[model samples]
Target: MKGIKFDGNHSYDAYQLFLNSYSIGEAEPNTNLVEIPGVDGAVDFTEYFGGVTYKSRILKMQFTFIADRFGLNAAYAKLQNALNGRRVKIVLDDDREYFYTGRVSVGALSPDGQIGEVTLTATCDPYKYKTKVRTATCYGHTVGKGVGTVDSPTVTLIHASVTNTGGAPAVPTFNGDKAFYVTATERHAGGSSDTFLNESESLPSGKDTAISGVEIPAGATQEFGFCCVGEGDLTVTIKLQERSL
Candidate 1:
């Protein structure tokens, strides 16, 4: 686990002196599987009855630490700071990374006066822990000029938004094989879009505002294109991450 690393505003091994046992919580699906009322016993109706979503519950975790008065105090301080509500990333056994982004509450503290060791328990809010993250960038393109592309390296859910600080209306195209577009009616206002694709997607100047989802296969490069619809410049930002299968 030499490559194993972590940072919760600090290094993971920084607490090695006090660190005892660490374990990750189980992962649950972020979707609802509903059953159809009139289905026959031979067929599973629930599989076709409801909508599935991408939101996950908090990722529960536990860590045990053994330390003395000074070590205990230092460990407490580090965990205390993490409780301020920022996410803490942990690289589990050099496998993958997970974050404690919600709540991190400390359990009861136990002290061994004679041995000078303290035991502590910590809990994290539920979350479908995230894996590695990657980024892609797209430059602004004027309306009717050409399309812009944003690429990704894995099967990912692309979260993207574009801000037009300039004084003009614009339309962005999201294209892979099929095309999706977003339109802005006024100037200086910002608009954003999200899509998942394996190959590529483009944004063109148009008046349609409907958005859709796309699939980005693993190791595939996805692209996003844009064009000015009115009179100002556009700035596009895109984020990509692999989704739990």
Candidate 2:
């Protein structure tokens, strides 16, 4: 049967939670719908202004596994530790190459007979989920230099770091679509904040002067690139997060 693999440790497909290497079932993925209610008997519009809109979505899965008496208890014990309140990665289809991260809370363990079967119902909590991330590192980048080009793979969320490799200070700035800027002293590292893409209202600093909430769409490229001004060998590392959908 078709199944999904759970990865909490980034082991790829190695650590599927299925006890017998099989997935029993899954619930239909649901959309988190937001309904905007209209004022009753409003004079301006024909229909009520209230309509259902969609945004972040979530899914719940009920996976059952079977193991002999020898492996039953061990499997349940592993599930308890592996899934409880943990942000885990999931791969539903390898061909699709899509991944998702969410908090997994495993419900009660129901044992059928002594060790024949165990059913685990897990609820996935999600504000967002990510597919595989692509990372690139630029080393020994000099100041007052121009970076050639930068692009996003999807509606990507990116986190970047500029580490001072030399003895003196460096200030790095990336200007273009969804640009990022940082100012760091000697031997210090400054980068994008984790909340840079998550915080919609305000700009969060990455321990320096930077802008948060840069939304880069898929297949879009930034032509300007990032540059630095300072005394040290600057290493720039960038990580991009693509939405699972």
Candidate 3:
């Protein structure tokens, strides 16, 4: 047996690359060898359909578990919160969604008792995005005139007792004349007041039309062809913005 010399001073030729039990930078030399490592993770998803284009958001999470005598291989993340990490969902409701899951990644393992970052990621396809447009159409409106000219027309809202019986946001809004729903105030002023007359529920600020609302949800839609008494041309436009989880 050739005597492999153990020189107290690590030899650059071999000691430089020698495997050790613990990380090298310990305040005091720790003989611990079974320490596991560090960790990291990520997820991606895309969505197409329901009138929405594409939106993405990352739900970041941290994994800080040092391996005990057992080993880092035993480290585990339930990922119940977010499997493929969280992305933005347009639907404003409490939902426990099932995300994606990929292979596990360990932290950068240190040779000399150093720790490694274990990273795992779950990627998905456009989870959800949409334009929630809250509105109702009253066809036979008398077609209010310059009322669309930011002139707060004296005409009252079409449906005095009108109620949108749906889910979640039940009472869309019917304040004043016609403000059950919420939108930008510009639509009222900048809109074509010649004859094409219509009003949307004002946003939280009491402004109508200027801003757009989300697309209608996936469910039974309330249909109304005309408002007989004073019929007018009604049009609806929905605008959407990207959001995070």
Best by lDDT: 2
Query: What stretches of model 1 exceed 4 Å from their correct place?
Result: 1-7, 11-17, 29-67, 70-78, 81-100, 113-141, 144-222, 229-235
Cα lDDT, all candidates: 0.37, 0.39, 0.27
Per-candidate TM-score against the hidden true structure? 0.44, 0.46, 0.23
lDDT tens digits by residue: candidate 1, 210-236: 244433443444444433323233443
Clashes of each: 29, 4, 59
Better of 1 and 3 by TM-score: 1
Q: What is the lDDT of residue 42 in candidate 1?
A: 46
Candidate 3 lDDT by residue in tens digits, 30-106: 12233334523322122222222322222222233344424433332322222233332211112212222122222
Evaluation by TM-score, superior candidate among 2 and 3: 2
**Candidate with more favorable, higher TM-score: 1 or 2:** 2
* Candidate 2 clash pair list: 143-228, 154-218, 166-233, 196-213
RMSD (CA, angstroms), candidate 1? 12.6
